[model samples]
Target: MHGTETIPVRRVRDGALDLLKWLALLSMVLDHLRYVGLSLDGLYVPGRLAFPWFCLAIAANLQRVRGAPVTGQWRYLGWLLLFSVISEVPYRLFIEDADTLNVLPTLALGLLVARGWQQKTLFDRGLALIALLLAALFSSNLMFGFFGVLLPLAMLLVFSRPWYFSVLPGLVCVAANQWQVLLDSGNLVALLGLATCLIAPLAGRVLLRYAQGASPPAMRRWAYALYPLHFLLLLLVRQIIA
Candidate 1:
């Protein structure tokens, strides 16, 4: 009998990720603008679109780089770290309720979860478990952090499945986006925010169908710039209104 060898499975490329990242960036900008441009009106509905998309983007990146070298992942994480530091002061200045730690910390922790699960390293795995427990316990305060930790596993579950299977993770992802409203003490804006999260991913998935593997480095860099720039601009506007 001929010896059998296990073939390494390659993950399929989903264009939905890039589309989702761009969309999340847009939603985040809109959300931030409400703080700066229209704080009184409660326009958090459309802004709710950002966080889930960003989490999805992190998941997509982890999926693509699963078997690749570690150095690149480290480098990408470095960029995020740098930007998170760069954006924090401005972010704090811009939002009334801005926390000491912003979304980047959550994203970074989520990256650890994804990389740890993908590599199955003892240290990474242990750290991820710890992070997960912490995030779950403190989800109300660490919304993005909690979502980030769970996002990779969710992506892995649906990574190679048909679109129908994705529905399960998609719902979980949306639920993560606006879960506060699910509680008995809820309001109209929170309900609308939940609706927006559910619908936004559909647009992302459709865009990915046509634009997979088409984005260039220039566009990606520009997208990063939008995060801080938008915050600064909105802050300026908010100051004007005040």
Candidate 2:
């Protein structure tokens, strides 16, 4: 008892955070809808908000527990790893000529990087190093790649700071979205898409910070299944309608 450490204050759950999760999920669904053969290229712009928002959620979670004891850290990483495998087939089936694994892997690695930055223990730092090495080595085959893996850390860095700090991750979000592909397209929508990516983190932070009042369904571990399930459902709908 002589050496016991004081536990930091645990923040209450924010309804706005839940709202952000739902919005991120909807953005993801909207982004995927483009593959539904609807010629909805415009959906790609709003979809740009999805990954950054998700990363922001990760940052908010880590930020909430800063200096507090981390519970279920392994379990959190386990779910991401498990779903990364589970989601791959559905992801490939939905996106033709899919060049990368599903986005969960990127999120999974990003979680490690952000966690490492937060915890800073020898073990966590080692794990973070491994996550970065994997990201660097497999950038081409991972959805969003190395930059995506870093976005969570970037968001975490600015989680408690003023809004301008969101710009750090905003640029990372754009890079992860593959700006080169957008620029090559040479369309007004493509240009707008770049702006959308650059603004997504700031917009999401604003929502998390100021938006309130609506109680959304708590997104639990069960939501991990939704990533793969959505793709399967979309594939089914595509076959039925197309």
Highest-scoring model, TM-score? 2
lDDT of each: 0.67, 0.90
- Cα misplacement distance, residue 127 of candidate 2 (Å): 0.5
- Flag regions of model 1 displaced more than 4 Å: 1-17, 37-42, 137-140, 182-188, 199-203, 213-217, 221-225
Least accurate 10 contiguous residues by lDDT in model 2:
1-10
For residue 68, give model 1's deviation from the true position in Å. 1.4
Residue pairs in collision within model 1: none
Q: Residue-wise lDDT of candidate 2 within 1-242, one digit each (tens)?
A: 45688777765668888899899999999989999988998998888889999999988888776766777667888999999999998999999889899999999999999999999899999999999999999999999989999999999998889889878999999899889999998898898989999999999988987787768888888999999999999999899889
Model 1 C-alpha lDDT per residue in residues 109-147, reported as the tens digit of each score: 677777778879898789778868877777765545466
Q: What is the lDDT of residue 105 in candidate 1?
A: 64
RMSD of each: 5.9, 3.5
